[model samples]
Target: MNELISPKYQMKLAADVEKAVWDEFGSYKNVRNYIEKWYEHDEQNYNWENFRVVIRDDKNIDLNATIHSMPGEILLKVAIDLGVDTPDFIPSIPTFKNEIKSEYKTAYDTFTKAYKQIESDPSTAIGLANSALESIIKEILKDKRLKSKIKGNETLYQLSSAILKEFNFSSTEHPKEIKTIGNSLLTANQAIEKLRSEKTNFHGKTNEDFLIEDALYAHFIVNSVATVGLFLNKFYKTKYPKSEPEIEEDDILPF
Candidate 1:
C-alpha cells in the first residue's frame, strides 16, 4: 500500500502551487483565473475585495484574533485535478509561539498582525511592526516604574531611548555583543520611523509608493525590532520583584 501525504503537507504543497502561479501570472486577476479555472458561476469574482466582502457577512467572525496564514492553498488541489504541475517553492511564513506577560500581550498581538500582513500589505505591516515595538517599550517602562521620569507624549525616539538609555554596558570591558544588539535595535527603530514617516499606511498614500521588496526590507527590520524587544522583555525579568535590572551578555569573554 502506498503512503498517503499528511494534511499539513498537502496544504503546504498547495501553497507552493499557488506561489508558482502567482510568480508566473504576476497579477491578481490572472491568479483568480488560475484559481477559478472551472467556475460554475459566471459572476464569481476571486478578487481580494470580493473575498473580503464574502467573509464580512459571517455572523460569528473573529476580527481581533489574527490567523497567521495566507490564501490560495485550495487552488493547489484544483490545479492538480486540472493536470497542472506544482512547483517546489517554500513559503517563508514564520511559526513561533509567544508566551509573554499579560501587559505585553497587546504588543505581541500587533506583532502577530505585522507578520500576518507582511507579504500582502507591506505598509500596514511596517506600521503595525513599529506599533508593536513601541507598545513593548511602553510596557517595559511601565514595569520598571520609569514612566514618571518622562513628561508629555513620547515619540518612538524617546521610547527607544528609554530602553537604551543609561544601560550599564558601554563602560564594561567586553561590551561588544551588547553593543551589536543595541545597534541592531537602534537601527531598526530609526528605520521604522523613517519608513512610517515617508511610506506606510499612516499617511496619505494608499500604499501606492510601497513595493514588495520594500515590504521585505520592512519585514526584516520589524522582526529585528521584535528580537530586541523580546530580549529586553526577558532581560527585565530579573528585576521584576526587587532585584535591579542587570546586563549579562553571555559572549562577553575577554581576549
Candidate 2:
C-alpha cells in the first residue's frame, strides 16, 4: 500500500478540488456537491483510515479543559494529511473555509500575545492566567453539578484555591480565601438556577457544596488568564453581535 499522503499534500488537493468546483459552480453548494462526487468516485480505492486515527490521545482535547492546543496547527495538519484537491480556479475555498481560518488565526494570535505578556508584563499575565483558571473551575463545577457529583466540591475548591495562588492571588491557606472565592466566583448562581429550570440535565443534582480543587491544574498552568480571556472575547463577540470585539495586541518581537 502507498504511504499516507502528508498533511500539506492533502491540503493542496482539497484546495485544488475547491478551486475546480468554484470555477464550475461558483457557490458552496455546488462545491460541496463536487467534493461529494469526488469522494464517492475515489471511495473504492481510497484508504480513509490514515488521517482520522487517534495516534496519541491528548487530554487537552477535552471540551471542559480551559487550555488546549490552538486549532490552527491541528486543522492545517489535518488538511495537509487529507490531501483534498482543490481546483486552481476557485477564488478562495468558500466563506466557511475563510471563517475557520480567521477563527484559528485569532486563537493563534491570542496565545502568542499571552506568551509575550508573561515575559514582559507579569502582572497583566497573572490576571489573565487567573481568570482562565477560575473559568475552568466554574466549568468543572457546572459539569459536576449536572452529573450529581457535587460531593467533589471540596476538591474543586482546593483546586481553585491553588490555581488562584499560582496566579499570585491571596493565600490558599488563609481562612478568608473561602470568603474571597464566594465573592469572586465567575459563574453566577442565578444562571445555574435558570439552567436548573430549563435544562433537564442541570436538575439532576443541585448543590454547590463541593469545590473543584484540581480543575485548573488539569487544564493549564502559567498562562491561564490569557487563554480564558481569549475564549471570552471570541465567545462574547460571536454571541453578542452588537458588541464589537476589543482587539488586544502586545509587543511583537523585533525579530
Candidate 3:
C-alpha cells in the first residue's frame, strides 16, 4: 500500500485518518465497532480483514504505524465515513506574513485568495500572488524604516533589490552559491511581476492578449512568491534580530 501511493499523499491521508479517528470516534475500538456495524448491515463492502488486522489488536495499537500501513483506498474510505474530506496533495505556501512585526493582514489575505483561486481562475491567482509578494516586501521595508528609499512607483524587481541590499544579500562579501541564489531570487521576482502584467487579466487584457489559463502556471508563480518571500523574511530576521526589552528593576515586585 505504501508502495502504491506517493509519499506526499500518504502523509496527508495518514494525518486525516489520525484526526478523524481521534476527533470523531475518540478511540480505535469505537471506530472498529462503527465499521463492524456498517459491515453487519451491508452498508459498506470495504475489505474488513486488512483494517481488522491493523486496528483490532488487544494491546494499545500503534496508531501512527497502523494508519501509515493501512491501504490508501481503505484509509480514504474511513476518512469519508468519518466526514473528513480527501486531502489535496499540493505544494503549500508557508505563512511568511506571520513573521513580520507590523500590520500584514492584507498581504496574508491576498496570498490566501491567490491560493484558493489557483484552479478556478489562474489569471487572477497570478495577479493576486504578485500583489501579495509586493505587499509583503513593502511591509518589511516599512517595518525596517527603509520605505523612504522607494521612489513611489518602483517595480517588484526594484523593490526586491532594495530590500535585498538592505539585508546585504546582494553583497560581494557572500559566498558564490549565495550570490547565485540571490541573483536567481531577483530574477524570479521580476518574472512574477512580468507574468502578472502581461500574462494575466490584471491590467484589463484585450481579446487578442495572451492570458494564463492553466493552474500549473499559477502554482509556479505562487511557489515562487513563497520561495522569495520566505528567503527575504529569514534573511531579514537573521540580519536584524529584534532586541529583547530590558526588565526594569524598579518595576519588579519582590517575591
Candidate 4:
C-alpha cells in the first residue's frame, strides 16, 4: 500500500487526526495502543509492526509523514474511527433529487466512482469526473426545445457552451462580473475535457504520453464537476421551473 498523497493534504489530515485524538481521549495517553487495536482487527491485516514504528512515540509521532506514507483506505478508516470529516480534497456529491424533477443518474454514479478512486486510481478518477460533467450537461439538454439545438455528439465544452447560452449566462446583457464567471466556468470545462483526453486513462496512452498519477489533479477535476453540476441544476430549475398540475375542485371528493 504505497500511497503517495500530497504533502499539503497529508498535513491537513494529520492535524485533523491530532485534534480528534485530543478531543476524544484527552491527549496522547495510550493513543498508540488504540491505533494498534484498529490495525489488529482490520480485514486486510495491515503490517502492524511497520505502523507501530511510525507511531512509536505516543506524544511525538510524526503524523504528517506517517499519513503521507499510509494507504488511502487506511487513512480514511482512521479518520472515521476518530470521528473527523474526510479531507477537504475529497469532494462530496450532493443528492440532487429535490433540486430537479429529472434525475441525473449517470452524473451521480460517475462522480461517485471518481470520488471513490481519487486516491488509488487518479487517472481513472479524472476521466470519470469529466464523464460526470458531460452527463449532467446531457441531462440538462433533455428538454425538447434544448434537445433540438444539439447534435447529440457535441464535446463537453460544446455542451457546456450550449447550456450557458440557453441560460443567458454568456449574454452580454448581464453585468461584467456575471459574464466573467460564466466565461471562467467554460474555460474550466475545456481544461477538464483536455485533461481527460490527454492525461487520463480514459483514452489509450502511448509510451510517450504523460499520465496523471497525482491525487491532487483528480481532486481538482472532481471538485470542479460537483461545482459545475450543482450550478447547472440550480440554474436550470430557476430558468424553467417545473409547473404544478392544476387541481379542479369538481374532481376532489367532499370531506
**How close is every model to the real structure, measured as TM-score?**
0.53, 0.19, 0.64, 0.67
lDDT of each: 0.55, 0.35, 0.70, 0.70
Identify the superior model by lDDT, candidate 2 or candidate 3.
Answer: 3
How much is 137 displaced in model 3, in angstroms?
0.9
lDDT of 4 by residue, 1-255 (tens): 225555666667767876776567654445545655644334466633334326554555554555555555566556645545553544444333223224777677676667778767889988988887888788778886564376668889999888888888767789999999899989999999999999887899998999999877776777777777778888887888778999999989998
Report RMSD (Å) for each prediction in the order shown: 14.1, 20.4, 8.4, 8.3
Model 3: per-residue Cα lDDT over 1-255, one tens digit each: 235457788688789778777777777677555555433222365533554334445665556776676666566455544545432533336344444325567777887777767766889989998888888788778764554466557788888888877776667789988888878888889989999889999898888999999866776787778767877877766777778999999989998
Model 4 stretches astray by more than 4 angstroms? 1-73, 77-102, 145-148, 248-251
Q: Candidate 3: lDDT over CA atoms?
A: 0.70
Better of 2 and 4 by TM-score: 4
Among all windows of 10 consecutive residues in model 2, the one with the lowest summed lDDT is 59-68
Better of 1 and 2 by lDDT: 1
Give per-candidate clash totals: 0, 38, 0, 0
Candidate 2: residue 201 Cα off by (Å)? 40
Worst 10 residues of 1 by lDDT: 61-70
lDDT of residue 187 for candidate 4: 95
Report the lDDT tens digits of candidate 1 across residue range 43-94. 4464323122112244432211111122243243344333343333112212
